[model samples]
Target: MEKKHMLQIEGLTKAYGNKIVLDNLNLTVEQGDIYGFLGPNGSGKTTTIRAVLGLVNYQKGNVILNGFDIKKDFKKSIQKVGAVVETPRFFENYSGYWNLKVMADFYDHVPRKRIDEVLEIVGMEKRAKEKVKTYSLGMKQRLGIARALIHSPELVILDEPTNGLDPQGMKEVREMIIQLSIEQNITFFVSTHLLSEVEVLCNKVCILKRGQKIEEGVVKKLLNKDYEVLDIYTPSVKKAMDCLIRDNRVISINPFSEGFKIEVQQGYADKIVKILVEDNVPVRYVIPRNQSLEDYFIEQTKGGEHIA
Candidate 1:
């Protein structure tokens, strides 16, 4: 059997005034996939989402939702898609259940029990009757998710879903997204600057910068650094670098105060230690810097930063 995409963008481009926001960007989210759009703040992550949501006018590109072109079947394409970009607004005075009911009213087939089911799905069953004003930030986020799911859409898009969340709140939301993807088999298009979160939740991710896509690949594949980083504090930085650079396995050496960094197999610490000891170079400490998704992102897209 062949897999199909839930959303597909080809040669998508966008700009604001003289500055480009999304330049020839192409992406796809397969059915039942948890795809992540990741980059720094100014890397056009939000812009791409807006373009995909049809919230912005793109100068050129084609977006296909299932088999329907987003431009041709604009309303029909979005009928099955639900999105929450940035902070989701709600009726402050309305209870959580009431808010969901309001969104549910937009579609007729969704039953009242469906609202209850979604509330439970987001782990807000106990807080269903509570006013939105009384809800915490995490609860509000969960409510936003519940509202999106209220209509029982097949594709869900969320932008910075964990912003302003405490550690526990972030963890909870991450777990919820993962659970929904695995248990409910939902197709999720997630846009986030949180690389660690993307690393944890997304199977595929794209890195954007200055409106241009710099890299796109599977999360693990993009992050599978061929060489690990080894930092060693020694008495002579230059000498350490010179000796380490002789090895064919070493990629590059970055000099640091009182030490240097070697990009090589971290397990070969014994080889380095032995060399230094044999050469009578005092080795203060040898450490391996555990690379995370953020580390890989920074390494891949070296110049981008949080612009927004």
Candidate 2:
């Protein structure tokens, strides 16, 4: 089957008088993709999302979703797209189930059973009767996601869904996202500043800086380094270093706390260990230390901070 484009942005530019919020940005989100839109705070992530949803007007560019041009047919373009931007707000006094029912009323074809189905999809079925005021931040975030899914959208967009949650909450949200993507085959466009979470959750990513795209590609390809680096731990550091230094496959070796770090050809780690053990050096363990998404982001942005 051929892959389809779920969302496409071409020359998307938004400016406020003298300040430009988005500068000729172009992005393509493929079907079934968990695409991460990453950047520091004030990096035009929200503005781009708003433009895609037709909530904000752009000076120049086209926003096409599911093959419908947003400018020419806003309703048709957004019919199958659901989004929760920034922080999701709910009726504080209403029950979770009630809140979802109200949202379902807006759609004419949404069956009442969809409310229950969405609650189950988000793992909120058991607590569906609980009032919003009594829920924790994480639970509220999940509920927000459930509401977004109530319409059975083909594409779901979330803006900083894990913004203020605890570590465990963040983990729960990430797991939920992964589950939904696999089980339902829904495409997600998530905007977040959390680089670590994006590294694990998203298969594709686009990084923005100050209002322009700096990098965009598959996560693994973007994080790939020129050579593989490994941390070798053993009591006989001197002996192992001496042995590896003689091998042509070992590019370089640097002293580390436990043993040493070696840059070698990708498949040469096994040989290094074999040489070390043959020379009476005990091997504790070997850990591959690849360049991380955070490391690449920092290098591209040049001293930019605020991302977790």
Candidate 3:
């Protein structure tokens, strides 16, 4: 069954004076999807996010939250969405519970029980009474996520959610996101420059470059479409290299400390091995290289300067 879209962005365009930020961008977030909105420093990711939340006015486009049009029903549409952009801010002197209490007061129908529930969901229940000023950066981030959920929003949008955390903090936040998505069935649209985080946490991703979407799809499917990098170890390096070099599927080959790192088209590993064996080349081992999200991102955004 086709999952219903929780958020839809169509023909979205935003311009700043003479410069264009988002150029006719289109994206979608389906129900229960942990969608990753990815781009380089100045690929219009933040601008696109702001436009969706109605934080900035765009020259053209429509943002639909569920079935409510953001333009026509701003309050109703926005109420269903929760966002923590850049950083989550709170009164330093106030306790975590108090900070969430204050936020809950702003929205009608938000029960006190809901605040406790969200706090527990983010695993901040123990420190709920502690002052925000005394909390670590990771704790504060978890509280920020709790605040975003206080109103029971159907869709959560986060920008750089783990920007400054240490390794442990990043892991906690990542696990929390997965847990919330599973337990609460909430849809997430997160924008971040951390490719590793996106690779681990997101099932779907949209890559934007120079204010335009260059690629968008499932992470596994996208990575599987390309060749599987392999490190071929053989005593007969010269003979194996010469035999495989003639194949049209071999993309590139480079000498490694152990052997040669070869990039070959998918499904050509067996054929390459067979050729080496047929030529009486002594093959030691073949190690498949896993492609990282960073490698893919760098390849896609080549020649583009990093922008703020």
Candidate 4:
């Protein structure tokens, strides 16, 4: 089955005063994708989301949602889209159910049953009657997700959904996102600085830097297609280095705790072992360390110092 395009941004450009926040950026989010929108702090992520949701104006470009151009038909374009940008806000004194019911009023005809359904979907059904102020940040995040799903949207856009969460809290949120994607069949557009989370949760990613897209692809492909890093443990460190360094496939060799951390072009680890063993270099163990999204992100952004 072919996947339809859920969100498409063509030449989406935005400027503030004389500064260009988004520079003709192009992106496509396919149906059933958990798409990660990644960048450092000043990389125009917020601005782009604002433009897409029509909260802010753009200088030039098209924001297309489910084949409807936002500029031409704002209502239809955003009708089926739900967003929880930054931290979700709610009336603290109200019950979680009450808050959701209040928000449902914005739509034309949101039945009371939908409030219960969304609460159940987000695993907040048991605590539906609790006041918003009693909920933890993680619980609040879940409530926010329930609110977003209240409209039965096809796409949900979340900005730093797990921000300021503890390890367990983050885990719950991440698992919820994965489950929602699988069970509900909803496409997600998540903007987060957590590369590890993105690696685990997102299927595809678009990386930005200084308002321009630097890299975008399926996560697994990006990890495998790029250079492969290996941990080469050997008693003959100098000898192994001498033998492997001469090979053109070897990119770099640095000292790791137990051995040399060798980075080489893809599919060259076997050749490296062969050369080292042939040269009488004793190999203790050869462990292949797959390049992590964080590693790739750092390499692509040239040491992304601002990544939180």
Q: Which of 1 and 2 is the better model by TM-score?
A: 1
lDDT agreement with native, every candidate: 0.84, 0.90, 0.87, 0.89
lDDT of 4 by residue, 173-218 (tens): 8898899899889999999887888899999999989899999999
Positional deviation of residue 148's Cα in model 1 after best superposition, in angstroms: 1.1
lDDT of 1 by residue, 1-308 (tens): 76788998899988788887788998878887889888777778787778788888899999888668888888888888888878888899989999999889988698999999999988999999989999988889999999988888888999899988998888998888888888878899988887778888899987787777778888888777666887899878877777778888677788887798878765665687788788778889999877777777667677437622
- TM-score for candidate 1, residues paired by index: 0.90
TM-score of 4: 0.89
C-alpha positional error of residue 113 in candidate 4 after TM-score superposition, expressed in Å: 1.2
Off by over 4 Å in 2: 231-262, 270-287
Instruction: Compose the digit string of candidate 2's lDDT tens values, residues 22-122.
Output: 99999999999999999999999999999999889999999999999999998888888888987888999999999999988887799999999989877
Q: Over the full model, what C-alpha lDDT does candidate 1 score relative to the true structure?
A: 0.84
**Which model is ahead, 3 or 4, in terms of lDDT?**
4
Q: Candidate 1 vs. truth: CA RMSD?
A: 2.4
Tens digit of lDDT per residue, candidate 3, span 1-308?
A: 99988889998989999899999899889999999998878888888888888899998989999878899999988887888877788999999999999989989999999988999888999999999999988888888999889998889999889978988888988888898899889999999877888899999999988789888888877776567688999877777788888789999888866679888998887787788888998889988878876767777777435422
Going through the candidates in the order shown, the clash numbers are 1, 0, 0, 0
Model 2 alpha-carbon miss at residue 144, Å: 0.8
Instruction: Identify the leading candidate in terms of lDDT.
Output: 2
* Distance from true location, Cα of 62 in model 4, Å: 1.0
